[model samples]
Target: MNTEQPLKERLKQILNQNGHALSFEEREILLHELIDLHGQAKEGKNNETEQIRQAFLHNLCHVPQSLTHETFSRFFAENIKPADFRALEWEMPEQYFQITEALYLLRSHIETEKVFDYVTELLVHALRSFERNGEYKKMIELLQLVPVPPSAMNQELLSLRAQAHIHETRRVQHFRQLLYKYLFLQALLIFVAFPILFVKAENGAIAKTIEEATDVEMTEERVQYLSYADGLYWSIITAASIGYGDITPVTNIGRIIAAILGSMGVITIGIIAGLILDRITPRNF
Candidate 1:
């Protein structure tokens, strides 16, 4: 029975059932409806759209289920892209715009195969967009309708490119934030804390430790000792076993710090090493 069916006949039936097709009149109706929905969502009335979207999503989540939102699975490949749910971009709430953009980029990628290159493009696009002091808020509108020629293959490719770019940029930003936090914490260890913590140095450290003529110089110095950064770095270096010889603690209490940091270094290294074994490990990129 399936083999006897025409491809367009089967697809048309499926799309119609999934609410994908739009006659010119239907497109007009959707345009106005989307504008209204956008306004309502902005006014915090997305309960209706949320309900509609969720119902379709949940139904497809069943074991014997759909291949798209209401039809095929999201990952299904086809010649032309399925019309995006957020086809009416301007009609969406501002907060929903980014997510809508993300989905569009994703769907576009499904239609096109240039996933990695598209993502790199988005990163650069975001950077240049920011540098130009370009209009950030309305830029999303420009994004959705990036003028694919009427050809099905070209449309599919551009959509995919746009989607890949968005996904990569978002992932990169999230990763960048983690790195920034790591660096900030690292800087705190290097510049702010190591200078103050000291224990009477023995061996090569003794001459330099004695020469400082200072340790815990003021009230700020006293407060810094209580901070976690003090122990964290000591632990990091000790754990890495890099005893860099430069940043070790000097004062009596500082030497006491070395003991704690040294022990911490051991535990931290084990944790970092174990993290590498997981399946969805944090991307270093």
Candidate 2:
């Protein structure tokens, strides 16, 4: 409840403007009660502003009950931490959602006072926390619900929105770059290294003999020692770090090449995993 007489008068005027018609006696009774409660509000109570807002909310049919200043003070003392704004328990999703909606409501209607400015600051804090959590899209979505403030605050919100977009874009680009690198390496193994290895193996002689007998190519024909499709499959599976061992190199040189490829695969996969974690993890608030 607001103790200031002028603010009480302003509230009366605002109520009348919103189509509430209170008799003179009724208005006097309500204003005096609020003033008395405001007088009783203790020192060091953190939720006096919230109590006043709740009074307005009750009259506006937004809340089930209007909280007294003392009740609000006690509630917050028990439930809220003075440090970071996290609730002790996040199990009640609907309660959190309702609080967000209530804040939006307050932002839209409340006059630009200290209380309203504090609400705006809380919204900004929430935005920063969401950004740190890597919930960029969610942060943007929540920001959209906030009514535009004065030019300066609105610009600040817009800047935060832009920052979220830039980070998301960078994340996407990093993923695409990693993907391209992996695919290029896979292609090199399939198209260049695999063909050379296949042609040098003893299997190449047998395959060449079969090709000549079948007249698939002339005696001068270049033999394809391994199936190109099989080589591609092996490249994909090996890079994925899932060697099923169905098809393997038979020669010593081929085994050495496989060892090198397996090592490269391990290092590349580790790098990719680290990049993904970096993208998802939240930065400092």
lDDT score of residue 19 within candidate 1:
47
* Residues 35-54 of candidate 2: C-alpha lDDT, one tens digit per residue: 44445555554465335333
Alpha-carbon RMSD, each predicted model: 16.4, 15.8
TM-score for model 2? 0.37
Off by over 4 Å in 2: 1-98, 102-121, 131-153, 201-285
CA lDDT for candidate 2: 0.51
Q: For model 1, how many clashes?
A: 19
**By lDDT, who's the top model here?**
2
The alpha-carbon lDDT assigned to residue 97 of candidate 1 equals 29
Model 1 lDDT tens row, 1-285: 643234334333433444454354443333333333323333253443443333232222221122323223232222112222222112222323243344344554364444333333333343234324434323333344343234423443455445545654665576566655755764565445543343223222443544566653322222122334544544456546846665555345566657655665565467446544431242221
Name the runs in model 1 displaced over 4 angstroms.
Answer: 1-61, 65-157, 187-192, 200-239, 242-252, 263-285
lDDT of 1 at 5: 36
Candidate 2 global Cα RMSD: 15.8
Backbone collisions counted per model: 19, 0
